[model samples]
Target: MSKFIIITGGVVSSLGKGISGASIGKLLQLNGLKVNMIKCDPYINVDPGTMSPYQHGEVFVTTDGAEADLDLGHYERFLDVNMTRANTNTAGSIYQTVIDKERRGEYLGATVQVIPHITNEIKRRFTAFENEVDVSIIEIGGTVGDIESLPFLEAARQLRLEKGPKNVICVHVTLVPYIAVAQELKTKPTQHSVNKLREVGIEPSMLICRTEKPLSLHLREKISLFCSVPTQAVIECADAKSIYHVPENFYKQKVDEQIIDLLGLTPKQKVDPKWFEFFDKAMTPSKSVKIAVAGKYSELQDAYKSISEALRHAGMNNDAKVEIVFVNTEKDNVEEKLKTADGILIPGGFGGRGVDGKIATIKYAREHKIPFLGICLGMQCTVIEAARNLCGLHDANSTEFDPTTKDPVVDLTPQQKNVVYKGGTMRLGNYTADLEEGSLARKLYGKDQIVERHRHRYEFNPAYVKQLRDTGLKVSGWHEGVLPEIVERTDHPYFIAVQFHPEFGSRPLRPHPLFDGLIKAGLKRKENK
Candidate 1:
């Protein structure tokens, strides 16, 4: 029988519920349980694929090509698991499923409501994971008492009844804010939050209190008394030096032990030696490498969450601390900011908001022989930069930015020309590309053919491929007929650009080769200097 643990947040959003859930999941893994994670989003969008980075942060892509919540990225990094499309679903997606079934007469003409139809669909998503793993940890987005969260909460309540109390545990995370005037942490918000949750027909078995300072015994007792949880079930969550330290932090607080006791499960093992080793190396690096990321949404680090973690993973593999310098191409002098960096990266983005600055940065990296990596929109900009500077096509550009350019080096694929719906309509998920036998890409990947996750609609123009290749630029990887997937400069030290997002596939224990290659080149440059 599969057990279920549902994590919910209260008192605020961004309270680290995702990290809490992931840390608990890690503890379960250490105990020899096959743990799986699922993220329940409250938004109406079917996925974050079409949402702006400013609106929803980074859209994390699963191995199966599902564009998921950024929390899924945290789950993958902590659990070291490859999440599939089934691991993520939004309120919009659930409603869409219910409606699709209703249209097909699965409901038999009964008018569907939020109670039996929507909530049932939500429970079905939870039940789908029952047979696949020993335990499934589901994180509910949004705080308690929100109108959007009612259905998800109700579904969780019903699931506990259906699966029996022994098989279900509700873990609620709430904030314990401190006031400077009183110089004390308040528990009113957390109590009210728990009160609100209880009103929805569910009581949290454990409460993870988020606090700025160490939790007091008095405060724990107060929270325990008010929230109706045992004194030990009120676990304190102090801020950690790094998010990776969370599992150990939770272990110190006995959160995992409490969870095991509540679930009535016996551990096969109490610790994973490999995890401790990885954490040790991650904390104590011998040296450091600086990599500058030129991105439009650089102000908010969460906007480039996966890229930041991928660089860290590569840094760990190379035994170097990764220092990421965020350069906002929309405002900063791109060349001057990146002049002292060991390597440069141009991440994906939409619009022409900072194209000129990005083009200048790419040109600088190319001419100076600095190790450079371009991803998605970044790759398109690289091609455009090469076409304009080397091929002498003065007005070369992507049609996405300038439709009236004399030379359209990048344009929309034929398949996307007539697509009217903007959301979830793109060349998404995974696609295979044929790698040139002796090319840099094949060498880095150690494979002749590669499958990568893509989330773009534009491609390098086939008409300009010959012209660009003749100018010493290499088309190292390609898709079915003339679509360029990977480009490299043979003359430069380590300049490669790919239309796919490699950062999505990178893991802490197993860093992606492209990132490892870039970090290696950067470390060499540092040593040479």
Candidate 2:
């Protein structure tokens, strides 16, 4: 049987419960324990697929085409593990499954209730991968007192009881706010948070406190006294310059030791603290580069969390510091706004609101000899802009917005089969793309064939390939035998657009090649400036 670590949050939201869970999973992996992470979201959406980026940050896609909560992205980047659709479950999805079964007459004339039917589905999803891995780190979305999250919390509570105390453990992440005037770390918030958890019959075996300042011995003892956890297990998670430092920091706090003791499992391997030394060096490195992200969702920091982390990883690899300038390309005066940036980056997105603005940003990058990197929708827009301005194809547009176009520069893949509808139908997750030899992408990746995560449906139409190439646009990457997946401006300085989201696979320790190349271009641009 697999040991389970259930991570819950209380007091309020945005307490880094997901990060704490991911940190624990990473520590377990360092101990040579095969680990898998799962997230239970309380939202009513079947998944985050149809949700807006403004609402839920980025929708993380899995290998099996599961559009999961953004925390799954954190799980994948932290542990360097490939998760499947089975790893993410939401209340909407669970209830939907149960309702579908009932409609099919599978439940057999019984009045369905949330307790036995809904909670059963939740348990089934949780244990679906029980025998597949050594440890499963499950994170409950939302706070302890949320009305929507009550069913998930109840289901997890029952699972812990059924799985036995030795097999299951709960870690509650709470905030420890520091009052600048008082010059002390407050502990009442944690006490109330733990009291809330206990009221639900789920006493946390450990408390991970997130705070700006380090927890004092007095504060730790106070929390332990009220929360009912040992002082040693009341781990302090101070804000670090980089998230990668979390694993080493938590390990130093004896978090892994506590987990081992609680689960009654033999320690598999010793964690090497030296692995994070390189990351530390990267964080405090001497060299620095500025990369401008011309994205639609720049107002919210979480909007580009994966993309920012990916760039940080690349900077770490190059032993440089990446300074991100969040440029809102949707602004009216975008040209003046992006004038001083070292390099231009257009990330993935949906909808048609800021598309013309994104295309304008792409045109500016191409015309001004700036190094440009485009992802997903950014790639399609680059092709559309290039076709219209450079190739003189005035009618250039994506089928996503103008599906009835007579001369579509971007259109849905005709050869793509088994795609049902718009909600989850896009070619998602990990897909292989063949790069042309002697091209910029091939040289940067150092490989002819590469696989990356994709989250878009519209692609560059091959019908305009000859026209685009004749006008200085190179179709450098393709899928199967036909569809154009990457387009590079032949006449410009390092302008490239890729259909896949390389940010999803990037880690602090392992940077993606595309981001590495973009950072290098940014550094070169800074020197030129």
Candidate 3:
């Protein structure tokens, strides 16, 4: 059976609960344990696919096509483990399942309630991975006092009883706010947060305090006394220069050893030298490069969280610091915004918002010979721009924006035509693309056939494939030679677009080839100038 570690947040939101959970998982992995992390969202939405990026940030699509919370991306990046549909659950999904089961008479005329019914469903999902993993760190979404989180908290509390307290541990993350007037860190909030958790029948085995500075010995002792946790179990997660530094931080604080001692797990191996090397490279880069991201959600960086992290990882691989200049096409002039960039990146997005600006930016990159990398919607915009400016089609556009356009260079895939429900239907997850024999993509990837992840509805319309190919747009890759997956141009130095979110698969140690290629091109363009 897998030992369970439940991480819950309190005092405030956005306290890096996911990062902490991921850091713990990384340490356990170093100890030669097969560890996996799962997320439990308290929201009522069945998935985050229908939520706006502004509200919930990016909807991370797993390889199994699960539209999960963005924290899943952090889990994948840190742990290097591919999550699945079963790794994430929501209140909405749990309720829907229970209600459907009841309607089918699975409960046998028993009255449905939140206690046994909802809590049972939640427990089943969390413990489903016991046979597959040695340790499963489940991060519960939202704060302790949230109404939507009560059932999950109760379920975790009950799980401690069923799994035995020796196999279950709760790590509560709470804020340690500093009072400017008093110039002292307050433990009152932390105390109240822990009190709230205990009131709900869940006592924390560890307390991770989020603060701007290190917790003083007095502060740690105070928290330990009030929260009833040992002084060493009061971990301090001070602000770090990079999220990658967190695992090292936790290791330094002996959090990993503490966790192992409590869980009664013995290490097959003690330390990981590879993680240290990766962290060293991230902290000390040789050079710096500037990349401009042209998008609608430029105002909110979280909307393109994974892309930004991928770029950073690529820069680290090349020993360069990546500085992102967010260009809000709806507000900023596209030409001016992109003129100073070493490379231009158009991240994946939906709707027609700031799309014309993105198209203009793509045209600028193409015409000026600036290195350009386009993602899902970015790829569609590039094709549309090529059809309009290069192929002499003045009104080329996607049906997603202008359904009445005469030249529909980009349209919904035939398979997605009947996907009336907007939640989970799309050409998503991992798919293999056959690369051209002698193309830039194949050269960068060093393979003829590559597998990438997708999160889009529209694809390069096959009817206009010949027309675009006739005008110097090289169709470098395809999915079984039917749907275009990667498109490039031979005339330019580095102009490529992929109808998939390659950023999703990029990692800190091994960057995605596409992003790595773009950063290298950016370096070349910078040196030439």
Candidate 4:
């Protein structure tokens, strides 16, 4: 059976609970322990698919087509593991399951209450994969005192009791603010947060203090005595230059060692102290490039979390720093805004809000031979732009933007045409695409076929494939020979777009070839100019 590590937050939200949990998870994996991480979101959305990016950041898609919370992205990237539907559990999903069971009379005619019914399902999600891995880290969403987190917190309290203290442990991440005027670090907020946790019957085994400055010995002891936690269990998490450095910081405090002793788990191998290979790369970079991420949600940096991280990984590998410049696609003169960029990227988004701007940027990149890359909706806009300019189709547009245009260069997939519901109804998860010989994608991937994650409803309409290609558009990659997966132009130095989200598959040690290729092209442009 797998040991459980339940991470909770208190005092307030956005305390880096996800980062704390993933940091410990990476430390566990380095010990040769098979580690799995799951996220328990408090939101009632069945999934994050329909939520606004501004509201919840990015909607991270899993290998099994699960549109899960963004925390799962942190888990997968830190542990270098593939997360699936079972890894994401939300209030909406649990409640929906229980109500469906009730409709079928599975409760034996008894009035189903929230406690035994809802909490039981919640615990089921925690233990469903217990025997399959050595350890499972579950991070609870929202603050401890929030109304939405009550059921989840209660379920966690019960699980700890049932699994025994040795089999399960709770780690509370709370803020310890430093008052600038007082010239001192405060611990009262943390004390109250712990008190709240204790009131809910969860005695956290450890308290991870998120503070701007390192906690002094006096402060740590004060927090431990008041919070009823061990002195050694008071971990300090200071802000770092990179998230990858988090695991290294935890390792210094021997957080993983303390955890193994608390849970009585035997390591599969000796833990390595030099587990800072990724962090080391992140700390040092000789050069830099400015890549403008022009998109619909550019105002919110979190909306493009994975895409930005993927680019950062490529930069680390290339021994360069990636300076991301956000360009609001809703604004005017997008081409002029992107002219100074070493690279121009158009990330995925829904609706036609900033599509004309994306098209204008694509046209500028193609005509000027500036390195460019597009993804999902960005890819669709790339095709639409080509049809309107090169193919001389004055009314070219995507069906998503203009359904009755004279040339529907991009349209919804046949299967998506009838998908009436909005939630989880897209071409998602892992898919294979065969690359053409001598194509730019083939050279970059160095393989005949590759698989990547996708999450989009529309695709390049196959009817216009011939017309676009006849005008210098190269359909270099395809799925099932009928659907286009990648497109490149014959006249440009580097102009490529893919229907799949390669960012989802990128890792720190092994960056996705597409992003790495873009970074390489960007570096070339910087050098030549």
**Each candidate: what lDDT?**
0.91, 0.85, 0.93, 0.91
Q: Which of the two candidates, 1 or 4, achieves a greater lDDT against the reference? A: 4
- The C-alpha stretches of model 1 lying farther than 4 A from their native spots are none
Winner by TM-score between candidate 2 and candidate 1: 1
- Superposition TM-score, candidate 3 onto the true structure: 0.99
lDDT of 1 by residue, 1-529 (tens): 9899999999899999999999999988998888999999999999988888878899988777788999998998889998888899899999999999998999988989998999999998987778988889999999999999899999999999998889999999999999989999999999999999999989999999999988889999999998899998998998986788888888877887888888888888867667766776688899899999998888989999989999999999999999999999899998889888999999988899989989999999998888999999999999999999999999999999988989999999788888999877778878888999888899999998888888888898988888888877878999974789999988988999999999988888899889999999999999999
* Alpha-carbon RMSD of each model: 1.4, 2.0, 1.0, 1.1
Instruction: For model 4, name the residue pairs that clash.
Output: none
- Which ranges of candidate 2 are over 4 A from the true structure? 180-183, 402-406, 413-421
106: Cα error in model 3, Å: 1.1
For model 2, residues 239-315, the per-residue Cα lDDT tens digits are 88777788889988889888988898776788777667776677677678877787778887787888888888888
lDDT-best of 3 and 4: 3
In model 4, state the lDDT of residue 353.
97
- TM per candidate comes to 0.97, 0.96, 0.99, 0.98
TM-score of 1: 0.97
Looking at model 4, which ten-residue stretch has the lowest summed lDDT? 273-282
lDDT of model 3 at residue 74?
97
